[model samples]
Target: MLRLLYVMTLTVCCLPLIPGLGGVLLSAASYLPALGLNEPNLDGWHAMTSWPGSGTALQLSLFTGVTATLLAILMTFLILQRCWGTQGWNRIEKWLSPLLAMPHVAFAIGFALTFSPSGWLFRLFAALTGETEPYLWSLVQDSQGFGLILALAIKETPFLLLMSLSVLKQMQVDRLLTASRSLGYNASASWLKVVFPQWLTKMRFPIYAVLAYGMSVVDVAMILGPSSPSTFAVLVWQWFNDPDLTQVPRAAAGAIALFVACFGVLLLYRLAEYFLVKGWQSWQFSGSKTYSLPGKYLFGFVALLPVIIIPVLLVWSFALRWRFPSLWPTRTTTRFWEQEVGNLLELAANSLILGLVSASVALVFAIGCLEYRDKYHKSVPQLVIAIPMLIPQLSILFGIQIAIYMLPGQWHVPATIWAHILFAFPYVYLALDGPWHSFDQRLTQTARSLGHSAWKAWVSVKLPIVLPAILLAWAVGLSVSFAQYLPTQLLGAGRITTLTTEAVSLASGQDRRISAIYGLIQAFLPLVFFGIALAASRIADPQRRLARHADKQVSSNELISTKPNH
Candidate 1:
């Protein structure tokens, strides 16, 4: 049974990456036969390098992606240092789920509506100053990358916090704090010197995930990024959507470049974390507190912006007569909802089914893989799981599309669902990895010694023990599936539509009502999944209690059976 599970896990989670990578690699090198480019060439590479403003675009992408990712990490560390295991930490913990639940596209749209040139703030400025000259500003689509960086940073901070929570939990922050405090250090100083190094090490994976995500992000970048010299992922996305046949190879090359850039950034981040935190251990010993982070203020500001943004979006979605210089909507109607209701119903159904199916499948495979790893003392490589997580969606997706077309069937629902599964599996695997490794293995052995078969022991013991982690991984998978843009777009072949693509495409036209409806629905999917995860984790608390009760019963039964009267 265990061996079968091992094989099933391999088939479900790890094998698809071969075809995924192969398809992209072939197309990226211009060896695509379907497009009549049988002869491999460097033309695609040359085209990517020679494009107008390409260098500027790459620089802008780096600036926004790297800056936002690092800033979020720093903010996460500060928040943890000050608040972890403290009274204030509870409030932040409560907020983390909803913040993490908000979709990137939704957050980006709301951000623009709140801060852009024609946005609410500017209108307020016009009304207050009585200057109708309409001073020109284009911050929303500013040629520089400030808008993109700010939006990405805001969207990413919540994720970093959530990730930090997991790391902090594993680090035994309370014990470290107590130990350091006994050495005469201040509370903050104890955290900086003792807890941070361990936290940083555990945090490397999430940091890499963040960096890769920010660098490779397409939907968020499209909503808030500069237009004249767009980010690299956006540029690759445009190329993939280009109607011209000759541009496909260029798009493939761009995807390859994105993959490379993601890898390079992660490598650099690892080196930097090592140098600052690990190699220079002296800083932990000798340095005076030079860096005083405004952590509470940063959290307050970051948390406030999103709270304000959501209400503003709610107003825009209902407003019929909202225009410049108005503090509030002049007219309100459900007509926006009325107009979009039917389309949203269909899109919502599609999104729900996709998220559910993909998340469930990934969960099963993840559990199998982890169980197999425990029993056999072997496992899949970490990099295999992370490749899909780190790589940009647009880069490999076009090749996957071509591969789909080459398969003996037309694009269909199954293909789209499979694409989601492929993408969602990595997140599911990573989510399960920590808990699985940390699980107490002796419980399963004890169950087996009690005359339970291996399968029964696992079903009756291990599954119950890890059910919370399983559910959380499933939720993570669902969010990954819900936020999918490129895979659904390319694999669905435009016949199948999801909320993310709808939200992004409509956002291009600047119709806030229509876009808001889609954004709300997009945000709702993850919230629903997260809610389920939270509930399941709570409900599964019974398993632990039941196990303890059963163990007590077994001990009592044995004591009674061993009477001395015989």
Candidate 2:
């Protein structure tokens, strides 16, 4: 039965890649029979490549993606080097959950509100300088996409930090740092020389995830990215939404091109990582000198950006009459809330239901796969499992959307939920991987020896031991589902509206009030689930005494290793 379920899990989560890719490839090659383009040819590819500003858009995507990823990585490393074992580290950890909770769209919305020429920052500057002139430069929708790059970098840093937590814990960073420092190296130099290479290698997937997102981010790019050329992903999105039916093949080709560009960028990043760590060693061994970074200040700014953005969102949601150069709203009203509250409840209900159902289903599938791997000592490779994550959503989603169109009856909700599950499963699997690997098998073995069946033993013995991780993984899946924009939009065909789709739609309307209300709600929902997960983890443990002790011991060892050597 377990083996059967494992097969089912793969069928549901992994099999779609076949049809998704095949469908897109077929369409890109102008082989879609239904549209009367039966001959396989390069016309679609020609159309896509020949489009105006196509090269510029592709360049923007590459530039913004690479720059943002590099900046986020550097920022993450600096924060870790400065605060890993100190009391400041606690604050960093505390800030991570909320920072991570803010969806990319919400962050982009808030970022636009805060940094745009007529935005609050300009108003504050005007108030200080008493100059009525609008700012000369535009960050939001600028031609260069610098704003998009900055926003992506700032938003992704916390995620990389979160991914690093397990790596650092598992790597025994404390001992390595201590050993390096004892060899007459300073703490910073020791970390730079010894720990960074390992951290970079282990952090490859998270960084790739960040890079993929940076390259193909549609909603956020739509909100804050340059408009003249737009990014490549946004260009593909526009092409897909074009009213002309013949243009869709071009869109399909564009999606394929975007996927190729993203894959190429990932490959480039891998090569850079190889050279920095494996292919090049002079930088590591020759480095006894390390310069101090303003990590505390940098971290403070990164953490505070979201904090500031949220309140601005709240104020905008309630503001009735607010003009430029005014520090606060002249008159605030809840009309937006009043008008949206009814629709908000419906959207929230839909979002909540979708998130819960998809996340729950994905969690079960992930656990089944993990258990299958453990039992058989053979399973799908990590790369196969991560296909959904590594591939650009725009690439496969177009094909998946077409496949859903062939299904009979109403499938918007199911198709949307299924799409959510497809994306959410990998995150849930990753969250559970560490815990499942670290879990003790003896507990289950002992239960089995006591005449308990495998299922019974798993239920009574293994389940309780990993309940916290399970709950957390469920929440992670929930969050991933909640944050989805493309899948919800494309698969639902705009008929089904979730908070993310709603937020992105409203953002284009340029109504700050309505956008903030949706953005706040979008960000708030997953946080509630995360809070519940944390509370449940504590409650389920009854006595988290051992966990607390282990954490303290880890922190103490880190602190001792990081202390300055006279």
Candidate 3:
């Protein structure tokens, strides 16, 4: 049974990559049978290279991608360093779910609405200046892609922090901190020297995921990124959308270039980690200064940024007449919501269906993979599982779509769902990885000793123990599916109208009111699941229930003792 499940997992999760990558690579080589170009050549490469601003676009991608990733990691580490055991950690933990649930496109929509030229900040300035409007530049579509960098940094920090939570939990962080303090180190110095290196090593994969995302994201980049010469990913996306069928090779080459560039960034990260943590031992001892960041404030801002963003989205959605130089809406109505209610409901249903199906399938496959590894003491490679995440979506989607076209009948819905699973599986698996590794095996053994079969033992003991993690991973998978943009766009071929697709489409119109409606819907869908996941995790956790029961008993004892004294 385990072997069958292991086989099923590999087939479901990893088999798609073969054809996906193969098709893209073949297309990149200019071997387009559909275009009647039978011969493989470098024409596509030449065309892509010779395109105006192509080089600059790649450079822009690299700059924004690398810088954003570094900023997110720095923010994550600083927050973990300063707030991990503090009161601020509580707030940070409380907000991580909502922050993580915010889709990139939704966040970008709110961000643009708040920070654009005639946006809220500008209105604040205009009110002070006693002007209805003024000529002012804003971060939206900044030529340097700085706005995209900032947005990505702020958006991805929550993911990094969440990943760190699993790692820190396994490390016995309190013990490490106590031991470091006894060894003549303050909290700041101890965190920097004693904990930083180890955390970075464990954190390298999540960092790679962030870096890849920063480089390859299209929806967020489209909403806030520069337009003159867009990021390389945007360029490739445009190429794929070009009407000319013969232009497919150029798009393929560009995807290959993106794939290579992303790999380069990952390599750079590995080298930097190696050298910083292992190559230089002196830094571990050289830092005696109590240099720490204001991470409490940083996390508060991180938490607060979304607070402002969500309300901004909600207010914009209903504002019948919201002009500049006004903090509050002058007029508001629900007619917009009323008008789009049916359509939005359809989109929401489609999106919810996709998210649930994909996440559930991915969750089952992830459990099988982890269980296989536990039973057999061998597993699929981590690199294999992470390929979908680490590679650019555009790099594989084009080829996958073509392969779909080759199939008979309408495969659009199935293809789209498969694409979601392909992408969502990695995140789901990684989410479960930490908990699966940390699980104590003795409980499972004890169950087996009671004459339970292997499957029964797992279900009776191990499953309940890790139910919280499983639920959280399922939420992560659902959010991942909800956030998917390009897959639905290319694969669904207009037959499927997800909230994400609608949100991005509405956002493209620059209609703040309508865009806000979709953005709020898109953002809210995942938050509902995340809220459920958090609540369920807490309620389902045996340890938490025990602790609550113990507290109740202790309070009862104290009351009884105090009554006699009184």
Best by TM-score: 3
Model 3 poorest ten-residue lDDT run: 287-296
Worst lDDT window (10 residues) for model 1? 288-297
Ranking by TM-score: 3, 2, 1
Off by over 4 Å in 2: 289-291, 446-457, 545-566
TM-score quality measure for candidate 1: 0.89
**Candidate 3 regions off by >4 Å?**
129-131, 287-289, 547-566
Local accuracy by lDDT, each model = 0.80, 0.88, 0.89
Please provide TM-scores, in order, for all candidate models, with all chains considered together: 0.89, 0.93, 0.95
The positional error of residue 437 in candidate 1, measured at the CA in angstroms, is 4.1
lDDT of 3 at 505: 82
Candidate 3 per-residue lDDT, tens place, 231-292, comes to 99999999998999888889999999999999988998898889999998899988564665
Task: Provide the lDDT at 165 for model 1.
Answer: 65
**1-566 per-residue lDDT for model 2 (tens digits):** 66876787777767778768978888888887778888899988899889999999999999999999999999999999988999989988777877877888888898998898878888889999997877978789999999998999999999899888888988999999989888877878877889999999999888888899899999999999998899999999999999987777899999999999999989988998999999989988885465565686789989888898988899889999988788899999989999999999999888889989999998988888899889999775778676777899999989988777766887777778888998888778878887888888998999999999999999888887789889988988888888899998988988888898899999999999999899888888888888898788777772585788899999999999999999
Candidate 1 lDDT over 344-444, as tens digits, reads 99998988899899989878777777777887788877776766777777766676677777888676677788878878887788778878867888998
